[model samples]
Target: MLTSIQNPLVQKFRRLQNAKERRETQLFLLEGTHLIQEACAVNYPLMTVCYTSKWEEHHPELRSIVLENCDRVELVSDEVIKSIATTVNPDGIVAIAPRLAQKKPPIPAKLTIVLSTIQDPGNLGTIIRTAAAAGADGLWVSQDSVDLDNPKVLRASAGQWFRLAMGVSDNLHELVTSYQQQGVQIVSTTSHTQTSYWDVNLTKPTLILLGNEGAGLSDDLAALADLQVKIPMETGVESLNVATAAALMLYEVRRQRS
Candidate 1:
């Protein structure tokens, strides 16, 4: 068993924790049996898996599956697993998987989610999970947003990240403009807007634009939107959390299309 944290393989896995290394190697660490299983189930390319003996004993079926599908499986000490894991208490398994390629599929007839400058990884991940659950066609994030591959983001997504088509764009305005050219309506959310979100015709091909946690959509992007709407709130409550707001908006689109 690999007992030392300095083992070459363990070092490689540890290096994957850094954003720059992840970008350079095109690899990231996925901890916990569920996340690793989700990746393997989707046939996402897995480079290596490290697990402790106790983990293998408790999850023999999963161990066999990992051994069968993965090219490399190392039996490591629990300490080694802990060293490589980002969580306070890991589930005794971690896998190294290649980063997902950014995809820009043809905009679907359904609603798309446009995220601008969303800095919180948990928020971004929860939004992604919500988007996938709501059957969003795709998701686009501005370049300034949190890294979709951030470990917290991955964990918050609850494996739904694998099921979604997502892309990052340096120019959100241009991206939204192109969608508009293709006859998709841009819907921006703001408190000052008089239009209620429910009033918008979401049955049409639409892109729902949500902005940063602190600042809402930039004025330029809001101005470019075909419609600006707001969710009606009780007095003294200004707004909802971005992810909650996204879920409400996306499901409303689904309700309309149904």
Candidate 2:
């Protein structure tokens, strides 16, 4: 077992926590048993896996699977696991996987959530989970948004991160325009809009545009929307959280199509 924190592999895993290191190396860490299981379920390539003897003892079947599938596996000490993981109390398992190669934007089928400058990792993760649950076809995030592979975002996704098809767009306005050309309706949300979210026909191929938590949508991006809709709120309420609004809007599409 790898017990020493000074080991080269342990140090490499610890370095992955930094965004710059992750970007340069094209590898990210997946902490906890659940994220590792989720990664296995999707057959996400596991480059290296470190787990404590206690974890292996309790999860023999999972260990067997990991041994069979992962490229490299190691038994590590608790201190080593803690050093490599971001969680306050890790479940004694973590993994490393290569960042996905750039792919074409998801085709706007039934629903696609288009986000611009969403900075919060938790909010983005929640939105991803909700979109997958609501049967949305895919997700498109602005390049300026939080990194999709942020450890917090991955954990908050509860494994849905692997199941969902997502892409980051360099130019959101142009991407929206492309979707519009394909006859996909672009919908934007705002407090000022008179049109209620439910009034729109979400059953058609659509792209739902959301924006930053505090700033909301950029004016030029908002102008690309074929329709502007609002979620009804109590008089005292100024706005809803970006993730909550995403859940409401996505489920509304699910509700309409059902």
Judged by lDDT, which candidate is best? 2
lDDT of 1 by residue, 1-258 (tens): 999998889999899889889989888888888788788788777779999998999999888888888889999998999999999999899989877675664564457999999999999999999998999888999999998898999999999888888999999889888889889999988888789999979988999999999888898888888988899999999779999999999999988888
lDDT measured at residue 152 in model 2 versus the true structure, 0 to 100: 95
The TM-score values for the models, in the order shown, are: 0.96, 0.97
> What C-alpha lDDT, on a 0 to 100 scale, does residue 163 get in candidate 2?
88
Q: Pairing residues by index, what is the TM-score of model 1? A: 0.96
Tens-digit per-residue lDDT, 220-248, candidate 2: 99999989999999899999999999999
**Model 1 residue 65 lDDT score:** 83
Clashes of 2: 0
**What is candidate 1's local distance difference test score?**
0.88
For model 2, the local distance difference test gives 0.91
TM-score of candidate 2 relative to the true fold: 0.97
Clashing pairs in 2: none
